[model samples]
Target: MTLSREFKVGLFIGCTAIIVVLALLYLAAGKGVFENLHAFTVSSKSGDGFTEGMPVVFSGFNIGKVQALELNEKGIVLIKIKIPDRHVKWIRSDSAFILYRPLIGSARIVVNTTNLNSPPLDEKKIPEVIIVNDINDAIARIEPALERVTQIADNVERLTSNLSDPKGDLHRILSNAGKITTNLASKKSLVEMVVSDEESVKALNDSLKKLKDITTNVDRILTKVDKMADKTDSEIYGKDGALPQVNVILKDIVGKLQKLDKTIDNINKISSDTSEGTKDLHILRSDIDDTLKTVEDAVKKLDAIIGLKKAPEFKVP
Candidate 1:
């Protein structure tokens, strides 16, 4: 069954055409060529090295791809994305587009629309900026905090080392505490002595109570004494009191005693003089004796009137 050259060539061409058509259908299916596409454009300050054919993810699901990329005159990258019209409702004016690069993967363009109630995004709208999830940048932002933490760790290490040193104040305090504990452990008799002195403690408490009672009694006594002193002072030194009359009487007595002393002095001088006759001298001596008798009789009458017989000794010189 060998065929002619022309027939063989036609058959080969048909087979090749069928294979090419099948290949094209497979390629179209893989590219989602049958799906309805909605065209939109996004502008970003930085594309984060995004190129054409990058997958556009929504909620971790690959929903579309970047169809084209171009830079405008302002040097902003414009990305044209093709998403299925079935997902058009997920795009909103408030939606955020991010060009994120993980620590170990190529850069990606993600679309997030948390509030779908907002107005739908306009066609060919240019996005504000490109946001990248760069771990290096995050770490760079936390560098100062990390440095502060490192410094704090160093200070803690130094403090711990100082606390551990036997010569440090903390070590000394711990040593003193250990010594106190050891002393308490060794001196069981001290605890027993304190425990056995219950009577002394009670005695001390009783003494304190007695002292308080004595203080109270003393205060009452002091109050009574103050009242008595006040009464005595009022009675003694008040106007129209007996003490005032006594003081006046004593002053008058002092004056009278001074006059009597002058008289006695004059009489003594007269007695000492020898210019008179002896009979006149005898008469003068008799008058002096009579005057003394009269003074003694007057003093006796005064003593009887003032009830001096019941009084203590009355010294008259």
Candidate 2:
């Protein structure tokens, strides 16, 4: 059957419309267009040149976009972000937001929310600025420190080069080591000469053996002396000794004293007999005196009788 031009035109138009609708649906899904969105506000000193439609990434995946940016009367940048409601729970009170520009990449807004138990962020809340405050100021501050590090490295390199030079003190130390080695090699014969004196070595060994023998003899003498001292002490201090002989001599002296006392008694009796002989001599002297007196009296009596007869005896012869 032959198709009419009007009919063909209408069929083509219908198919084209269906294809366009499907493409729009796919793009909207990729942009999270069908999902419910929540608005959160962040305030910062500066925007760091971030514009509307800039992606806001959570843990490296895009979760939202910056929908608007404005400045308040205080000149602070107010950023309004639209985040899908499905990911809104990830935005907590403790979450950190930063705008970072690395040395190699365009600036980006990063969200970090490792703590899930924190309180949820409120709607239209002004979030804190977490990164990239002043890039130019930081670079300016680090220039002097980097220059100092570079200067220190250059000084160290110069010192090392000076130490390695052949005419320097390190080279003189190495040359002295080589000279010492050469001197030791040339004096090998002197070491041999010192080791060759066998006679002196033998004398030293003999002296040591003699000293050992002397020590052994001294030990034996000490042992003998200790034994002799013990025996001498026992003999002098034992029961029968000179002390008992002295006691016997003292007893004999007492017996001689008794005999001397009897001799003194005999001498006293002889003295008494001599006194009796002297008394007898005095009695003989008295007897002689009495006999002489009697003779004198007889003479006187004869004289008186002769006078009375005197005239008759003269005539006869």
Candidate 3:
């Protein structure tokens, strides 16, 4: 019932080798070693956050891993990805890949298939690299713009501080405007007093009334003068007017004057003829005396016709 030492050591060694082999097989299977794998190369400019053995995910499922990375002849990075044959059909020729690198988390490669009906991606064909922007890269891109924004904020802060200072022009201008508004509001009662003054309104009304009275008086005077002018016109131009009587009387006076002038001329001619032809001077004197008396009577008749109380003294000359 005793075991040999050599056989015991050999048995121990064989059991140990078997356990190690089984463990290795189990690890390989767990890593998809037996699964049919297909590979395609992805070209990129540089390796930023990508590395070997990184999971390539499809629709949030880990379907493959990055197999290797190398630089090609053109200095571009070439990343080879290995996917299982069963999952290879999930990636089509029309598929898109996106690398998402967040600020606080690890980077991941995402694969999307646009058409399930299209042909699967060929292993021999080159894959497209998904360019992604990391947080540091995005921040670097906007650094200059952020600097300008910071300068603008500083200027605004200075302006705000100046506006709040009592010695500043902006503050003084606002204070002056507020004071003017207050002064105008305080003088509102004076404006109301001037507008509501009863004495000035009464004086204006009285002046208007006096002007109306003067106009009425002027109209009445004009009416009186018109009436007087009409009366004067009637007296001078009517059928029984004084102007017609004066005209007739003047005509009669002119005729009497003509007759008197003729009578005096005839007397003068008779006196001159008697003085030359009669030898007796007494008879010529008597004729001259009678003509003088006749002249005196004509003068008296003319005075009576003119309604004179006494005839003017009639001198022979």
Candidate 4:
């Protein structure tokens, strides 16, 4: 059972072909050809710098590649990027895809994902965004910053010159600060330093002492005056003082006046009764004199009618 030489040659060639096929498949697998590929679309307003086969880079690593570009009726360029299934997690909902084409470098789609833990991007959503850079606009924005930087540099130069000058305000401030620090560290107190010597401080303390003594004397005098006022108030208002004695004297005078008024009324009544009794005695005395005269006349008539001689010589009264 020996094989032919042609058959052996054919067997060798067939085995070689099978090995080559297997190696090719292995190489393709290594390059992710057999791996699952996911697709997603992004839109751009202008497709000026966008091109197919552009590498999508994230954190300096290529995660995907741009597959196709199509311009729709709305003048938007729709870009489709293909990524291996394992790298799909890098495209988050919060991820940004920027079409950054530097003036001096090749154009690329730069993907930046701030939060890698966010939800995965929904591939079915349409009209995903891609930001493109404009060189003219960037330059326009940078011109003001350049001007501000120049102004800041000039201001720094001026500040440095001022700080370096000996006659400048900064130097004066630093010199004053040094002098103040030195004064503070010295044996002299701040008050002595500000007032220009210990002598002035001693004089101030002496004056303050004298003022304190004067205030104490005044307070003592005021206390004595207050005691005098209290004594005077007690003497005037006390129960046995001059005010109560004077009230007692006034009451005694009032009682004596009432007794004197009663004595005056009794004297007036006695004088009226004496006056009426004297008038009645005068009238009675006058009537007695008239009766004596009539008796004498009747005795002379009886002597004449009896013709009898009356004895003349004997005077019997």
Candidate 5:
């Protein structure tokens, strides 16, 4: 037990080193150093009750912790969380992070995983923080619902009272219905008469007889028209009918028209040549005068041969 001063100093140094290592191991164990962890960033508009080291809970189990909180230049509050690998698979791409503040409790960060089979959210993806309804907000939402419930209750109460009262509007309405039923029962014969009156039956019978006569006339007329159509078809389009004769006449007319067309074409060509040759008006007038004198001499000789006393002068127009 009698140790030297140097030995005592060495012992003290050894104990200090051992204590430091144990503390480091304990810290690492508490922070899950041996377990696989995924880090994700969550952004919020307001960081009212959020802080570093807040627990991220899923189904009442704490699976992660907020590692850091930072406010960037854009004034957004960013919360960085580290979730253990075992629970990280539960955080889906469509998972929502809700910060719920109860009426009489501290704010809790809740992770809601809607789709279990969805792809896991990437560790580097930053999700938007969704703030849940606080006590005041929930109360504000329920006010309209409460008012609707009150209106429904009031209506139920009025209906109950109206049903119980014998002299109420509902009672009057039922009484009128009963009266209508009684009146209808008493006038059953009159209603039947109105539905089937004697004069209406007579008129209906007469109309049926007239419709039968009209149908007969229409049948006769249709038969006559059918005969007439058959006769006309036989006369017009039957074999050895007028249509063949008309076709032959039409062919003959067409042949004459072709000959007339050729004659017109020849006449047009002759007129064109004559116009081109007689470009001088004086020569054309002299030729016309000589042809007219020859025609006059022929006419005079024909009149003497026919023993005509005098022949009238023929003028060419």
Candidate 6:
């Protein structure tokens, strides 16, 4: 049953040809060769980004393909597009086609229809190919955002620069903190760290020592004052203290005051009696003065009556 070498070679060639035909069929089927297609033309200014059999997309779905590319006598390039009859309803008279050459992926021909119910597209009225460069759009979209990011980065860099500057507040504070920590770790006192001079430290220590001595002396004086106060309290308030003697002296003085009050009452009574005697003497003196005046008037009248008759004889005798 072994075949000849020539027959085997021909069999191999036929098998290879069958495989090639299947591949062609597979590729053509993918391009809608087996299905009915609706044809339309798209005129473009340039056909630089077009390819044959490229999928025509409608709303993210592949509905047709670019059938052929040609140039007319007026130097305008015409792209023939074939849409499946089933998808032809999506193409309206006012449908737009965009040749989107993206920055990241392969170029595509995109279809955008405003209304699915609109009149069917006419074959005579060719759709214009709108070229869109993704790179340019990307640059346009990214320019403002990139500028804002750059502004924010510049602010951050300035902040960092200020923070790191030797003359800045943050750096000065850190330097001070470092010196304080180092001084403390090296067993230098807080005053020593602040004053820097040993003589100042010695003077401060001397002053503190003098203050301590003055505090001790004040404490001793306060103790003595407290002892004196206790002694004074006992002397003034104890049972055998001067307070009881003072109370006895005060009682004796109160008794003397009562005797003096009685004596004062007796003296007031004697003054009243003496005032009564003086009033009687004043009345007796007034009566004696009246009697003397009457006697003198009678004598003056007797002398006037005797002087008429007796004076002539009495003068001779």
**How many residue pairs clash in all the candidates, one count each?**
1, 0, 0, 0, 0, 0
User: What stretches of model 1 exceed 4 Å from their correct place?
Assistant: 1-9, 34-37, 73-75, 84-89, 115-119, 138-317
- Candidates' C-alpha lDDT: 0.76, 0.72, 0.77, 0.77, 0.78, 0.81
lDDT tens per residue, model 3, 50-106: 888888889888889889988899988888988987788888888887776777766
- Relative to the true structure, candidate 1 reaches a TM of 0.37
TM-scores, one per candidate: 0.37, 0.42, 0.40, 0.39, 0.35, 0.43
Candidate 4: clashing pairs of residues: none
TM-score-best of 3 and 5: 3
What does candidate 5's lDDT look like per residue over 178-241, in tens digits? Answer: 9767766765355434444656666866999999999999898888777776766776567765
Clashing pairs in 6: none
After superposition on all C-alphas, the RMSD of every candidate to the true structure, in Å, is 23.5, 37.7, 29.2, 32.1, 20.1, 29.4
Q: Number of the top candidate by lDDT? A: 6
Instruction: Show model 3 residue runs off by greater than 4 Å.
Output: 73-76, 134-317
Score residue 307 of candidate 4 by CA lDDT.
35
Displacement of the residue 83 alpha carbon in candidate 2, Å: 0.5
Point out where model 5 deviates above 4 Å. Answer: 1-5, 33-37, 68-78, 84-86, 135-317
lDDT of residue 141 for candidate 6: 96
> Mind giving the per-residue lDDT tens digits that candidate 1 earns over 115-215?
99999988867776467778768788899999999999999999999998889989899888897677667654554344455566668678999999999
Distance from true location, Cα of 184 in model 6, Å: 9.8
Error of 6 at 75 (Å): 13
From the highest TM-score down, the ranking of the candidates is 6, 2, 3, 4, 1, 5
Off by over 4 Å in 4: 1-3, 103-105, 126-317
Q: Which ten residues in a row have the lowest lDDT in candidate 2?
A: 308-317
